[model samples]
Target: MTTRARASTMAVPAQRRLQSWIKQSRGYLFIAPAVIFLLVVMVYPLANVFVTSFTQIDTRERTQEYVGLDNYAALLDDSTLWNSVRNTVIFTAASVVLHLLIGGVLALLLNEQWLSAEVRNFTRGVLILPWLFSTAASALIWGLLYHPFGTLNYLLMSSGLASEPVEFLGDRALALMSLVLVNVWKTFPFYMVMILGGLQSIPVELYEVSRVDGAGRLQRFRHITLPMMRPVILAISTIDIITTFGHFDLVKLMTFGGPIRSTETIAYYVWQTGFRDVNFGYGAAISVMMVVVLSIGVLVYLRMFTAREQMYGETTTAL
Candidate 1:
């Protein structure tokens, strides 16, 4: 081709690219405000914490000094930090597992076709009551139930299950587990709602077809239900893990990480170090570490989810 002809052809591609860029820019423009808001509220705070973590701040003197990784180095030798890490792991794991198990079972039961609409509706409303309560309110309610002379001890004593009141929130052995129970109670409803929505979205025809093929309840659940619900379960579990890991309010209100710090999670440690002890640099280091751990967990979950989705898609395409 001649030079002019080749140039015109190249210009045609450039013109198309420009038009495509303009089209994409409109979508970006729509989201620019939200993106800007997030940067201001979320990104700025996170960046500030990261910067603060490397400094030694003296609030009394109103001073900041670059201390390199001294804050993190101090965390390495801090036995309380290690203890808090252990507590955080136990609390997060137990809460997530119980939430999934109890929530899954309830969602399954509630999805049953034999249940009357009124009964189902009422049961759902009641089950979701826990999710309606704020963290502070949940702490207060569970606190009352767990009081030494409270309803739980009364029931136990009256039923001959115990000879004395149990110090649910005051005993080191029981405090962590007691807090776990409250966390489960308050958060399971979230899993239930998400799972229930997933269940409802499933086509009834799939179950009917399985039954016609001589599949039993367990078989149908294993093959049809589980595979379909995997995405929802994974998504919710990831969210639960992050939230439970950072949980603080219940421990703060009910136990105050008491009875020798049995319930002192990393989150509580951060607050204690920063506000109560007035060690802002150390607290910021702890906070940054938490963000790192959570980011790693979320990345793993996302990788698993993406792999499973790809495999499922390929399987569908093959069939």
Candidate 2:
């Protein structure tokens, strides 16, 4: 080949490669702000937590000392840790289940054509009002509702449902469940909105086709709705589980982890241990353990996502 021809050929590919690199770099540049924000807000704090977990942080003395695995050992021996875990597990399970079932029902109901478009939109907006309220505000509102002479008790008594006021928060037997109900009321709207969005995305033609195949409402829901909503269900459920498991403020504000610590959770325990008791080392250990526990959930979610993607990819390629 001639020297000029060789140079020209090399120049074309080099320029093309440079252009490709620039295009890829532009995409990264767009995401760079988000990446930087995540590092500063999430990654850095988490790295700090991991490091702090191995150290003794004395707030009064203003000192931090490396203590290694002693904190982890203390956590293993702590009875309250197990209790908090139990409460957290129960809270998460009940909250997530109710969120899914009730949210699914509300989403399905809201999707119906029976309501006028304006009415439906207005109703959806009202339902989300609970979710938009700050957690502290919602907790305070529920605290009022749970009081002996509160609106709920007065209505119940006046309607002959109960003759006396019910101490919802003070009764140990009822405290946890009472708190769960309040949390569900506050957060279920988020699930409803998410599932409603999922429902909207479902092809209307599928429902029509199912009807033509002589499927009833229940059958259509089973065969069409449930199957199609699998992805949304997985995503929302994973998010809710983590949040519910780590839930602190509402329980803290409403019950103060009270009625003999029956409603105390992992997050509350961590806060008490680290902040209240000033046992920063032990609290950091609890915090680390909580992350390890939550990681199991994240792993499960990732596995489901991967499996779904593989199945979807296969189905797409086959078609």
Candidate 3:
């Protein structure tokens, strides 16, 4: 090969490398604005919260003084904080379980061939309406439904189910459950939509194969559908768990953590402490704690989910 030809070949490869570098740099450039926006909008505020958590600050004070662990120590001693923790846990668990179960069932129903395409689409469209509604609006509608002399109470009396009105939100016993039901109704459609997409992605051949092998409906669901849905369910449940734990709007609008703080959650507790009570330091501390707790919880849940899947798969294979 001539020296000129060799030089040209080397130059061509170098030019291609430069072009590739420019392309990669351009990709980063496209995302730079979003990254900067997030830093400005999200990271800076989070850093402020973390810093404020260690300071003694409130609406009454014009100045903030570093208080070290005072806020966290106070939080540990607070009974209401503990109560909010419990309520938050219960709310999250119930909401997630209902979201998955109801969403899964609805997805199954919609996936059925028995329903005509038009009927199925219309039903799905209706189911998504609740999710379409703003959280504030949904809260108001549910609030009316739970009113002492509202439609729900009137219906009960009309049907002779009860002689008088039921205090759905007013009574402490039913308040938490009532709020949970509303949260479930407003959010379950998201799970339904995601799971439905997962269901659609599942190959029809699996069910056909199972049927040809004389697998019953229950068997097919157990061995085929459940396994197929494991990943999708895991992802959906994780997102639901995180968001539900931090869920604020529905609880705030419906109950305001009312009836003696029976329905209080971490989100509401933080708001009440920071905004309403104006205990900025304490509220920031709680917010930080929420982040820590949620992180640990998600890790634990993922670990358990993976372990259970392994065990279940082994058992099924053995069977």
**Total clashing pairs in model 3:** 0
Candidate 3 residues lying further than 4 Å off, grouped into runs, are 1-30, 58-61, 311-319
Which residue pairs clash in candidate 2?
none
Report residue 285 deviation for candidate 3 (angstroms). 0.3
Candidate 3 TM-score over all chains jointly: 0.87
Give the per-residue lDDT of model 2 (tens digit) for 155-213. 99999999888889989888899888988999899999999999999899999999999
| lDDT for position 103 in model 2 | 90
**How much lDDT does each candidate structure score?**
0.91, 0.88, 0.91
- Ten contiguous residues with the weakest lDDT in model 2: 310-319
TM-score of every candidate relative to the true structure: 0.88, 0.85, 0.87
Candidate 1, residue 108: CA error in Å?
0.3
For 47-138, candidate 3 gives per-residue lDDT tens digits of 99999999987455588999999999998899999999999999999999999999999999999999999999999999999998898888
Error of 1 at 80 (Å): 0.3
lDDT of 2 at 247: 92
What does candidate 1's lDDT look like per residue over 1-319, in tens digits? 9999999999999999999999989999999999999999999999999999999997878999999999999989999999999999899999999999999999999999899989999999999999999989998899899998889999999999999999998889999999999999998988999999999988999999999999999999988898888878887888898999999998889888888989999999999999999999999999999899889978887777778778777222211
Please list the residue runs of candidate 1 whose C-alpha ends up more than 4 Å from where it truly belongs after superposition: 1-25, 304-319
**C-alpha-based local distance difference test score of model 1:** 0.91
TM-score of candidate 2 against the unseen true structure: 0.85
Runs off by more than 4 Å, candidate 2: 1-30, 301-319
